[model samples]
Target: MAIAVAATRQVLADSYKTLSGASTVWVSLHTGDPGSTGTAEASGGSYARVQGTWTSGSGGSLSMAELTFNAPSGSFSYAGLWSAATDGTFYDKCALAPSITLGSAGTIKVTPSFSVS
Candidate 1:
């Protein structure tokens, strides 16, 4: 049986609260699918995960504040959400609509939105 809409909304709301309440939530840039272990994370040339702030979930949806990354010279195809700046917990990942490519001295800014139905 499928989950009820109200139940789904509750689940998403609870999840949003948990994720946003974490001491720090990090947004990571990825060259490919981060996979289960968050592999393929971007590295080198000032690449680092940026901390994210999230808006309150409503109707089973929420959005992350804009994240700015001083990315290295490469192509990024995905983004991952983590529990910490370094190696902590890997929450989830999503593919970029139009993957990002940077030459030298580039910056990528993204505002991620999430929803569950």
Candidate 2:
């Protein structure tokens, strides 16, 4: 479950006050390529993080976005949200189970939530 953002964790652990709205959110794709350690955030490349249309629901606790790319060029098994349009800190991540192999064109949707639980 890709729930808490890194900033949220920092806030919980160190009382940091950084926060972001849906406008700064973006999604990145990954293939889990061999010799690639999935530790740092994704960057600009074939599997770069792209911005999407964002909407708020459930009193700002829920965020939904869809990324429509002109031509799908890679295979993606994981996805995540970043705090900036490019090269920003990753906020949340989710595993695309069964993986998603893109065709010539398609869209990928992601919904990340925050709650008081």
What lDDT does model 1 reach? 0.82
Off by over 4 Å in 2: 1-18, 21-23, 33-48, 59-61, 70-72, 103-117
Model 2 scores a TM of 0.51
- lDDT (tens digit, per residue) of candidate 1 on 1-117: 534686677576667647646524788999998888899999998889998866656667677778899999999999998888899888888899899999875899999877666
Q: Candidate 1, residue 39: CA error in Å?
A: 0.4
Which portions of model 1 miss their true places by more than 4 Å?
Answer: 1-10, 16-24
* Model 1, residue pairs in steric clash: none
Clashing pairs in 2: none
Looking at candidate 2, what is the lDDT of residue 41?
A: 39
User: What lDDT tens digits, residue by residue, belong to model 2 across residues 21-115?
Assistant: 43446666655531233343333333456665444333224344446433254566776666666666665666767776666345555444433
Q: Pick the candidate with the highest lDDT.
A: 1
Residue 53 alpha-carbon offset, candidate 2, angstroms: 5.5
**Number of clashing residue pairs in every model?**
0, 0
